[model samples]
Each structure stands twice: as structure tokens, then as C-alpha cells.
Target: MAQISNISKQLQLKCSGERFYELFKNKMDSITQMFPKKLLSYKIVEGNGFAHGSVVHWKYELRGTLEAKQKLHMDDTNKAITLEFIEGDLFKDFEMVAVKGEVSDGGSNGISSVKWSVEFVKANEGVAPPHNYLQFALESTKGIEAYLCNNN
Candidate 1:
């Protein structure tokens, strides 16, 4: 039996809530492009892009070639979007594994903080997933940070 584990990482970014959402919604492709090769291979497998119930196909090269379908299970009416994995490689199942781009704080100085996080669990015992999860996340943050920071 594979023991299930959860891993979550967060990042704080200086940007406004509304602008963050705008960048996230409008620039997802650009954001996706920033992801490492593993995440970049993942694609929405069902429904329309970014909507609830949408399924995304994710592939990681380091872990014996597995595909995980992430389903957008919830989008907060006010604050967040959550995706649950319905099927595919590495895990028996997973939920809200990759979370990013949410406003954590707002300020009067025309500045705000955005937090991004990713949480994932192994599906079974003995299956080592990719080692670059954090690296991938950080690179993504750096990419978005540079884009937003430079444009702002």
C-alpha cells in the first residue's frame, strides 16, 4: 500500500487582488509557458479552460511517464479556485494539488501581496514522483513576478 502524503508550498508576491486575477485569467498561457517542462506538458483535458469541472492533463518526465488529470472542483465566489485530480499517473487520486495566484494582502501604497501554493500526495507506496516540484513552483513564481513587476 502506498502511504498518502501532502506537500504544500506558498509564495508571497507584490501585486493587487484585481490585477492578480486579471493576470491569472488573461495570462494563463503565458503563465503555463513559465512552468518547467513537466508542467508545461500538462493540458486541460476536459471542459473549457479554467472553469470548474475542467480537467487538465499533467505529465512529468522524471517519474516513468505518468499523466494526471486535474479537475477544477471549486472556484470561490470571492477568493479562490481549487482543482481536484480525477485520474492519471503517480497517484491513486489527488485534490487541489497545484494552487497559485491569490491575493493575500492589499495595501494603500498601490501594492499588494499574492500567495501561490501547490499541494500533492503520492497515490501509492514506492512511487517517487518528480523531485522538481518546488523548483517548478519557484520558477513559475519568478516568471510571473518578473512579468508583473516589470509591467507594473
Candidate 2:
């Protein structure tokens, strides 16, 4: 068995924490429209919306249009969402990959922050953890934050 490692990144947003949480809980597919260059499309493969056990398929431009599937578990009261990677190139070197995002007030009124974290187990001792993938998550969050700020 491989060791499980975890990493997290925090970002401040101009948008409200409620708005940020709503995006993940209800409007995730809209992200493809907000960042077309990075995300192509997202479809609900099973279940409905952001409910637990819902599986989503994603097509995104990451080193040439990679595709992945994830199962979502959302906590509306806590403003948190978790995604477990089910299949994709990301799993090539990772035995399991899970990402979680939590939204909270960012020190002052009208400002918010999101903490994105990833936990993964490498496929083998020689396999390295996914740093670039985590960067992708951070950049995507920033892009969504900008989109929300500009649209609102």
C-alpha cells in the first residue's frame, strides 16, 4: 500500500462565501461557460445535481483535453463540497484522489475565502503526488471567483 498525502491551498475572493458555495452546490456546470479555455463541459452522469452519490463527468483542457469522472458529496449548511475522483488519467498514478472545498468569510464583510484541499494515495512508491493538478484547482477557483465578481 502507498502512503496517503494531503495538500491544501487557500484563496481570497471578492465574491461572497454564499455565492461561492452556491456555485459548487448548484451551478457547477456553469463553470464551463465561465472558463471555456480550461473547462469544456460537465454532465451529470448519475443522481441529481450536487447531492451525495451524484457522479459528474468533466472534459477539460489539461495537457490536451483530458476527461474525468467524480462523485460529489455536498454540505449546504457548512458551505462545503467534496469530490472523489472515480476514473481518468489522474488515476494513472494515484490510487485514489479526493478534493474538498470549504467557503468562509474572509476577515471582513462582503469578502470570502475558499480552502481547497486534495488527498491522494500514490499508485506506487515511485509515483509522485499530483502537484500540477492541485495548481489547476487553484487557478480554476480564481477564474470562477473573477467570473462571479464581474457578473455580480
Candidate 3:
């Protein structure tokens, strides 16, 4: 059987949960601008960007330059978005990979926090846990928060 593992990280933000959710929902076209050093391109190759049923093609540098195609599922009520990997470099070592990002109210402070999780089925147990990927999400979330607070 394939070995399955999950990892997650959280990032605090000055922006509201709604604003954080809006990044993926509406402002993803500006992804490269927000993280130019990490993300090379993010294009909606199929379906639509606003509602559900969309496929995004991402070309980015993690440990190295990698490309991925993913289908997006957005939950407005929960303020969460999921990206199910359809194809790309991720398949080289994993049998399955799904990434979920959730934005929530940060208690009394009224700040926001984004939680990112990666669930994966490894091709073999020899593969290390996806720490860098989770880190990437955290960094990206921070970038979004900074971009929104400073630019918008």
C-alpha cells in the first residue's frame, strides 16, 4: 500500500480572512507579481476562475523549477480553497497530492490566519515529508498579506 502523510502550517496576517480568501478567488492573476521570485506563472487554463470547476497551470520554483496543473475547489462559507493536483512534477514521487488553504478569524485580536495543509500518498516511504511545500504555502500566504496591506 502507498504511504500517506499529511503536514500543515499556519501564518498570521494583518488582513481579514475575507481579504485573504479573495486572493485565490479573485486576485490570482496577480500571483506572479506578489511572489515573483517563487512563482513564474499562474494561468487559468480551463474552466473559470471565479466559481468552482477551474484548472490552473502553475510554473514555479520550489526547490527547483516545477510545473503543475491543478483543479480548484473554493468553499466560500468556510473561507477555504483546495487544489487537487491533476498532473505535474508532483507525480514523480507521490501517488496523490492535495493542498488545502483555509482562512479564519484570529480570535479577539481580529487578525486573520491562514492554515495550509498538504495530504499526499507517497510512491514509497523513502520520500521525505513535504516540509518545503508547506513552507512555500506559508511564505506565499505572508506575501499575500503583505501585498494586500501595503499595496491595496
Which candidate leads the pack in lDDT? 3
| Candidate achieving the largest TM-score | 3
What is the alpha-carbon lDDT for the whole of candidate 1? 0.57
Q: Please report the TM-score between candidate 2 and the true structure.
A: 0.88
Distance from true location, Cα of 70 in model 2, Å: 0.3
Model 3, residue 46: C-alpha shift (Å): 1.5
TM-score of 3: 0.90
Q: Which residue pairs clash within candidate 1?
A: 2-124, 2-125, 67-89, 91-123, 92-123
In terms of TM-score, which candidate is stronger, 1 or 2?
Answer: 2
**Against the true structure, what is each candidate's TM-score?**
0.65, 0.88, 0.90
Q: Choose 2 or 3, whichever is better by TM-score.
A: 3
Which regions of candidate 1 fall more than 4 Å away from where they truly are? 1-6, 60-66, 73-78, 92-101, 107-111, 117-135
Query: lDDT of each prediction vs. the true structure?
Result: 0.57, 0.84, 0.84
Global CA lDDT computed for model 3: 0.84
Query: lDDT ranking from best to worst?
Result: 3, 2, 1
- Give the lowest summed-lDDT range of ten residues in model 1: 93-102
Local accuracy of candidate 2 as per-residue lDDT tens digits, 1-152: 56779989888877888888888777777866777888788888899775678998988887788889999989877788888999987877888999989899655566688988899998877877677678888998888888888888
